[model samples]
Target: MAFVPAPGYQPTYNPTLPYYKPIPGGLRVGMSVYIQGVANEHMKRFFVNFVVGQGPGADVAFHFNPRFDGWDKVVFNSQQDGKWGNEEKKRSMPFRKGAAFELVIMVLPEHYKVVVNGDPFYEFGHRIPVQLVTHLQVDGDLTLQSINFIGGQPAPSPGPMPNPGYPGPGKHNQQPCNLPCMEGAPTFNPPVPYKARLQGGLVARRTIVIKGYVPPSGKSLVINFKVGSSGDVALHINPRLTEGIVVRNSYLNGKWGAEERKSSFNPFAPGQFFDLSIRCGLDRFKVYANGQHLFDFSHRLSNFQGVDTLEIQGDVTLSYVQI
Candidate 1:
């Protein structure tokens, strides 16, 4: 299948180093900046900055520097009026020399959540107003592959901008629930054995995002896309922590199909937070965990329109779900 760019954003590819550009729509809560790159083989240091302006003297809202020159560590700080704030450091480094990496900087109400290579890395509290940040600057010993800005409202806006192709309010009535069913408004702390209507059902380019934490005693988690009337599962994603494998399959006509149990790596861990996304394409479903591509499951049930419900169960506590 051909690659599909994320919804509501265009990604930049193979840009020259010392990259500087105004962030499209600026920064806002619920927005994420994704960077894919390879660290230089003989790397010393690299940094990503979200600043108020284009130049060196501009006030920085967030400075993320990973140093490998002496001791390997990541430094987080902010700059105002040419003065840098106190540094917050993490001793362990996630990037490896000469290795490819996927970095996601997710903007939240109180802080920025950084995820590296399908794992939670760190969170840096806001020192400067996120609204003042306008440009993104990346400089260091690395070869950038792509950069994408995804899922956020424009700065100064009161709410999230509607995602492309998603149905708006009153188009379909949602099932009665304790949580709000508004688009982009995350459902927090939902109980396990959870199920929700998928609104307009599945379609190419639509993505479902699930974010949560895995308990230390976690064993397994199951996420299923089901046919409401026929009780068939269009897609079943099961991550078995005990066996250290992720299994994918389908259940149609009351029988389970062949199980796919292969993956390059498992992204889930005991006591770690995870961000999982399943994007529907013309031919298959693309799965990503913590911003890293996991695998694709081809359509076993050809009728995408009939897959209208989402079900989740076992070993995880959900903090957010976006369909």
Candidate 2:
């Protein structure tokens, strides 16, 4: 969403070889470039397409490439809506063949955060559920400058140490605890935990979901998660909103429990990201914001832990996440 132009980061117009940085978390990727040594016939035909596959043999695939109209264009094929949508034109700028553009793509539960040239660009949803994306191809004239996967090291930096106040594992027997964690915008002072982040690359729940930043106010702890059809979840603090489930007697449960004590947040805007913390255990959940108490609730008769699917209906950016 934001831009940082450094002094030595010059553009590489027609880089001859492919340059790559591998991604961690056992994720695999492939890279290839079709060199149109003769530029005329392939001038307009030049295109780069990356095939995102769950595994080596999976048939379901996601495709992405710069738009065919010309250079400096970025586009993707969405499998959920079954269409090829063009991203905002300004998302990709000053495109050139063989230029050193790196896509730091992390595939989350429901969407993919795709960062191009050290910045975030788009969040493609209804994502391909496979663990690996192993194909990259440049359709024309472009040179495959270099290829490498950002493997081994943990890409994102570790969050600040959990403070003594953090409840140990699922220990919620007592109430009102603190957590030793980082608050505020992520900094690159010591190499941003992950690579550069992009805007609109994160997906958050649009409806029945509230969005906001967590400033270090008074409380400590933030809980964010998706509850399943039969589960109950709740946020306890100054203010929060509930979606899908409801608040019953003492907790938030499924089956459209309660519509009272609703919290309001500005609808998610484009190109903005927020960090949240959440803890899930047994049949109960609690949410906090920026070290403050928003609210808390519990669920009954809901087997939600097994439902791992989460989808972000709108664009939101995420610097890092802890499972």
Please write out the lDDT profile of model 1 over residues 1-323, one tens digit for every residue. 33333343435766798899877666778777878778999999999999987776899999999999678999999999999999999999999998777788989999999988657899999998887787899999999866777655443335753332332222222333222222334454578888999876776667677766678799999999999999999899999989989999999999999999887678777765666778886788888775567889999998976889999999987755777
The collision pairs in model 1 are none
Worst 10 residues of 2 by lDDT: 1-10
Q: Global lDDT for candidate 1?
A: 0.78
The Cα error of candidate 1 at residue 283, in Å, is 10
lDDT of 2 by residue, 1-323 (tens): 11111111111223353322112222322211112122232333343334443333333235555543545556555333344443433336433443323444545456655655335667666444433333444444444422322212222335532222321222321222242121122221122112222122112211111222222231222222333343343322222222312222323543334444432332112222222333333444434332223344454325433333233221223323322
User: Once superposed on the true structure, which residue ranges of model 2 sit more than 4 Å away at CA?
Assistant: 1-60, 68-72, 78-94, 97-99, 132-138, 152-323
lDDT of each: 0.78, 0.32
